[model samples]
Target: MDRYLNHHLKISGVSQQLFADAAVTAIQQGSGGLLRRANHLARGALIAAAHEKNQIVSAEHVRIASTELI
Candidate 1:
């Protein structure tokens, strides 16, 4: 999960992990620990955070991520 997330994060122009611990937990639980879902959730959370002008991905961002996930 770390490797996959790192790759995606790099491609997304994120230099390092910015997900709050709770947000990480939320992404894991919310995605059922599935890599694909986790990836989508993480990406979506980044987008949500960006939309809100937040530098850190919070649990709220994770919720927004889930709602926006396809």
Candidate 2:
């Protein structure tokens, strides 16, 4: 999972440790489905990053995206 998270973090440009850790935990603990939620979060983060014109995906973006999924 660490390898997966690291790869996504690099691709997502998420430099914040807190956001990265939260993302990892979200995927690890996803209730309905792990892979599905991970993909959702990753895709959402990428969208959020693009929308915000941010090089790094932020915790706020993750939070927003997760809430949208919920």
Q: Once model 2 is optimally superposed onto the true structure by TM-score, how far is the C-alpha of residue 63 displaced, in angstroms?
A: 0.5
The alpha-carbon lDDT assigned to residue 37 of candidate 2 equals: 76
Question: All candidates' lDDT scores?
Answer: 0.85, 0.63
Candidate 1: worst 10 consecutive residues by lDDT? Answer: 1-10
Q: Write the per-residue lDDT of candidate 1 for residues 1-70, one digit (tens) a residue.
A: 5566678778879797888888888988899979889988988998999998989899899998899877
lDDT of 2: 0.63
TM-score of each: 0.79, 0.57
Q: Which stretches of candidate 1 lie over 4 Å from their true place?
A: 1-13
Clashing residue pairs in candidate 1, if any? none
Provide the clash count, candidate 1: 0
Model 1 TM-score (2 dp): 0.79
